[model samples]
Target chain A: MGQVVLKGINKFYDSVHAVKDVNLQIRDKEFVVFVGPSGCGKTTTLRMIAGLEAISSGDISIDGSVVNGLAPMDRDIAMVFQNYALYPHMSVYDNMAFGLKMRKFTRPEIDRRVRDAADILGIGELLKRKPRQLSGGQRQRVALGRAIVRHPRVFLFDEPLSNLDAKLRVQMRVELKKLHLRLGTTAIYVTHDQVEAMTLGDRVVVMKDGVVQQVGEPLELYNRPANKFVAGFIGSPTMNFATVTVTEANGSLIAENAGLRIRLPDGTARRLRGHIGHKVTLGVRPEDLTVAGAADPDHPCFDAVIEVVEQLGSEILLDMKVGQDVMVASVEPTVRVNVRDKLRLAMRPSSLHVFDVKTEEAI
Target chain B: MIEGAIWRKWAFFYLPMALFLLFLLFPFYWMVITSVRPDGELYRPWNSVNYNPFWTWNPTWDHVRYLFEETLFAAWLWNTMFIALVSTAISLVCGVFAGYALSRLNFPFAGSLGTGIFITYLVPQTLLFIPLAEIIRNYRLGDTPWSLILTYPTFLIPFCTWLMMGYFKAVPKELEECARIDGASRWQAMLYIVIPVAIPGILSAGIFAFTLSWNEFIYALVFLSSPEQKTVPVGVTSELIRGDVFFWGPLMAGALLGSIPVAIAYSFFVEHYVAGLTGSVKG
Candidate 1:
């Protein structure tokens, strides 16, 4: 019963339009993530859904009821902040029970819910300890426990795992996914880390400059990005892009520049036919580029010189120079490569991406 | 602690520390010694035989006895305590709310309002007392404990407000936001989350306000002219000394006794006061 719908959501701070028109429909029990760089309006959109920020001109409804004028307390939602936001003076049990008490729950009911949440969070033994006495991970668990005790209709998270160390962040991300599955509550999470969005979200929304760029399942975004920003933002090593002029040769389109040349695959060539003799941006992921082999003769290949090699244990990342442009390639760890080595790299023909240079949109 | 050598540690840390301590404690040492010294030794010429101004051979409680039994010193002590406590309580309540609003609430001119309050504190009390005296006479609160008690907050509220505003700003706004999202109203969030977290700041503000009102002099002297209504600072200075003849023993004893309460207050909350100034919230 937690279906949330937003229509034409916008937020303005004086003259600055912080969040532009955004419309989304979140299914019940679904986990959605909003991700972008700083000031990209992801957090602002979440806050608007939570009723913490006033929408400039829009309608937000939870469970099929408009909540535009409702206060946060009446929104029937819970939030986990980045800093945990535990009450410093209260014990863990009291912290978990505060919401229940405010809602006028009976004494025994409050106790039962508090203890149940503590057990679920594996913090039953820490009920009497204050927040300052707990470690960071333990405090984070208490924050989650506090949110779960109320059994709110929705859960909002604003960069909740950003404060943890790298290892802890990964562990917490798994726990968060498990928690969402068990609770079956609608959750909206906002973060700047694409990896977190990819791992935890059923669907991820990509935004830039206060505008929604793309919205779909995580794999859809990785497989088919709508624009140049999405392709570069979703992957770890990032997609390499080069501006090349589209020229027709032998009834096939060729994208060539001072640094490299590539034959556009059949599907991309058909869409890019009208742009011949005009400059178009070519994009390819690092994993899609590899050392050329005999089987890759039909694929587009180019010459490059290795500039730097980074050993990542599982794989090696080679920063190579192709004429004036620099590109990176992820190859097998056993491959022996060094700086200034001349190499031939091949791109998977089916994986090549081309974009209109002016619009920066996929072609 | 200097890292390398023992002499570097001593030269850089211990030597300077000892000298600083001696320089700071010299006045208190003089007060304590003079309060207990015999009147014969206190007024004697420094050039006389067996005249050691630094140390006294025989100590007496006569000066202390004179302070308590002969004059209106006990009434002055009671007046000062009552006035300081009442004024501090009034100032703290107003200061905490004012500070929270000025720091947390987004309103028109909030920044300038905070600065304006601080500017009032910077106005010297020396210049303020004259206009205040005229107001006090018109209100007919002159020559009573109410005069000092009411006037002290004129300075105390601004100081307490400015200190508390800085302290409230240091507390994370996320705590209150989380509380609100967790089903608490704005007032409830402030009471349960913000006020408890701001206890150290409140205590530091209370301690400073109490100390300021306790030692306040110009207002006490101008508003309270009667001998019985005067506070410790006014009574000890005007009553203990006659023209060209300073009562050294009784005067020093009164000074020594007057400072004990403030000293005790500082030591009692020294840890919290330092933490308040440093603005440490774990989150």
Candidate 2:
């Protein structure tokens, strides 16, 4: 129901800058995800926005009003924590009613809102149960239900599904997406899971080491990552990186790495015109490589020894060693591969991502 | 064969535990027998011939009557209960706040302060009684039950505070943050959430405080000049001995009666006592 904007945010714990001068604008009703590894400041940033943590130096605005100096309750934001911090002593009904009671809602209003949230979460039967009596997934719903009953301007989720089992996590993920759709409230979700980021976020902000690497639509970030970190982090099985030397072969460009050399596509090669003979990092997602039957001159080809093979029912993952360099590739489920077998892989030139070796920035 | 092996395994496990239980309960069984023995056989040395004399003869209510009517045993009981209840309440209030602060807050010299609280327990009561008596006299609180209630927390609070600090630490920090976002102030969050969750810990601390005050003798003996103001432990021991002539019958009767409140309290909070006592030691 409200947009959130963070401007020039910087947080420092003593000399260590936990969140650098970051800027983000989240529109009303948008589902934005902050994704990164631990210590990357994603949770810190979310906490700052939630007002659970103070900003060392920055401004956060909710619905165009500055909230940097406000208390969490005064900021009118409800947060669901990773551990689902439901009041252990309170029944689900009271847990959800706590914020309403604090707000001095009428008895009828509190009852109605709590019941409505319980229905939405499909936990109507669990209203009388204490939090310790509920399973992890149900407790997570109660945490969400607690936030929902508040009817705050914005909702903040800090890795809310990280504690559940794999299957429950997936089920809850879908439930959260549906909840967002039904409510249409501006929400900020933080997680390290890229799949959750892709499936849940309207805009995914990839971060690394307290700095914003890139922010864009999920597919846009997936297809055209702004940097090597974003490129490697956004994809499943991860994008492979190879240290290669870019050289002018005849009139076109080719990247030579270890025991493999492949001509770059015309469009991609033209972008590398000035960088010829320089060291670069070749980035390619596992899905972009195919197990080729023969050498295709039109496409880039490399021979690699299969070190490990994993069959995941619908797809096959190959861990291959080409000379001294190792890379992972995802092939079709029908592709037969064995350990120590030499496999010819054809790279899709159009899908090849290149980055400067020194800066690790996308070229 | 496997079922027989499993039975053997369980028997081996229970053998030591069963012996331990019997060893623990034997002393209480002797105390009960001693309290019921007839007057003539009460002082008899433990022998095979005198073992059944108690069964044939009539049990006298003389010791019990002497304790209740001839002495201020009822008054001692009342005084002990009062001091224990008041001190336990005081310790809980002080300990809970101090514990929460130590557990959650960052203050100047917090580590040193925690160490200081723990060190108070290490100071021997015998060593500090003279100085504490002087201070109590200075405050004009000597010879009053208030002096014991006030002094008992000196020992109780430090240990109870340490106990509660550990209990509060076990609660996740995020629980309070959630409550805060729900519009609870820090104190409100503690009152509504933290304290309720720590009921077992508080009960354990309360039992410790009550028992310590109930059984305390050194400070009570030194500070209380009036028989009416004396706690049960000091009063019972002082009245039982008169120039090497010990009144064993009335003494044991009073001792047994005095221990009942503490024993019953221990049984009520036994679970929490075990949990809280070890928990405080670690803290």
Candidate 3:
């Protein structure tokens, strides 16, 4: 196992800079995930670390040795591509053993490694079958097994579960987390799925437009996003945003939107002292808003009409319209509601996020 | 109405296909008939009065026997096989490497190199034979099978290289990339992954090179002045025509025999050949 340190890594394709000035330290035995939308250079960063792509400008060191000039083979890294890329002509056993054999390992040693990986992946019966004969999930395991048998210093996975069905993807995600724990090797995974990052990574790096927005533990990023992009990208049923102007109403900081007013919590108000007169964007997650009676004196509240409601057995997603903007609220599944029905909602100030309107930075 | 409509749909599908089959089969039938008939029946218009299309009174094996006995049929066959085999082997070796490079490498002006190879293929052998003949004579390779084997690749390599280039490109790049990461170098990857994956393309390209060298007439006719060194096409056509009195019997007989290997090769890998052609056209 080895730690990877990327210093001032920048990649450019002609005039278009793909990854810009990236510096990160991934500890040994740490699972770090790079998450972003397509073309955000997450995959490019992973590929550069794997030595598959050359760095236009930067230095990459693995276990305290510079590896920018090393070929992929010389770098001693294994990668699992999105398409799996298993050899179609070879059986699962041969596909997994190819890298070991290429490195001149003995036959008995290769067989032992192959059997161990297959047993770990639960694909012992598939050893004799060619890749083409296997299903997508089986091929994915074989691809993973191929990388495992190499026992490289680092494991690079580029959306390895993106091609599987939804249920299989979830199952594989759990398996991958367990596998990382078992191997205790440094793993750098790249994906656009935020849930995967939250579930798998010891540290998650959120990126946008080739720039790292924030890097932190999953809950750290979730609770304290560095910017607007990180805030919106880190959660599903995404955080809701509303334009509001902060005004001091009789000494209490009041955030006023059209047909809505929320009195800021004292701690949140102190953090926004410098931006009292400017327009700010108030952010709240779906699960942070609750259905409360109009006379509930716990926290600030709002009134909204339900536009749509989706019940997912245990929880419900309420699409409610307040004035002009629509926001989702997560509540108990048994909270019976209908379209166009007005309801009172209590907001939790601790869970609320505020960002500067012009800079999109957290305030 | 339902039965008639079903019949109409069946005919709509199979009618064009049946016509295509007959269109292709007619020429082979014509060649076989002409080869078997006597010299007198070479160009006789169909006789309606006798009403005999399948049956010919003077059907004989005279032409076939005369071809063996009169000319250097055996020597020409041997020379053609030798040149075709050598040319095909050399072309494949040169073409596969060039093709892989053109498909995968990102060197300076790689696109222009591919276009340069195809442009070389476009230069007709008939147009090139004069200068090539002079060069061959200067090198003292006149009337030698090596002349054809060496010159055949000038025509064969460019086209075969282009064919295999598109074939290799059609193979998923990730296959080789995965192998490269599996500790195989460029040459090892080509040997273990790219080549095996492109077997069908190479086989079709090989068949093309062989048939081209076999049927080539212009360069063979111009360069080979001796009957002993001439390939099948030049030897058969030149030997069977004596001062405008064409030896129709042995000429058609040799023509028939000369086409056998090409025909068998065509049948052996027809699927791959068609796929190769389609791939090249797209690329």
Top candidate on lDDT is 1
The C-alpha TM-scores of every prediction are: 0.97, 0.94, 0.95
lDDT of 2 by residue, B63-136 (tens): 78887888888888999898899999999999999999998887788878988999998899999888999899
Put down candidate 2 lDDT per residue, A219-309, tens digits, no spaces: 9999999899999999899999998888986898988977888888887898899888798888999998998865466888889999999
**Compared with the true structure, what per-residue lDDT tens digits does model 3 show for residues A34-134?**
99999999999998987778999999999999999988888888899998988766789999999999999999999999999999999999999988789
Model with the higher lDDT, candidate 1 or 2: 1
Clashing pairs in 2: none
Cα deviation at A341, candidate 1, in Å, is 3.0
lDDT of 1 by residue, B240-276 (tens): 9888788888889998998998999999999999888
* Cα lDDT computed for each candidate against the true fold: 0.92, 0.88, 0.88
List each candidate's DockQ score: 0.74, 0.46, 0.46
Ordered from best to worst lDDT, the candidate numbers read: 1, 3, 2
In candidate 3, what are the lDDT values of residues B8-127, reduced to their tens digit?
866875776789889998777766676788766665667636546555777899888888887899899999999999999999999999999998988999999999999999987778
Candidate 3 lDDT at B106 equals 88
Global Cα lDDT for candidate 2:
0.88
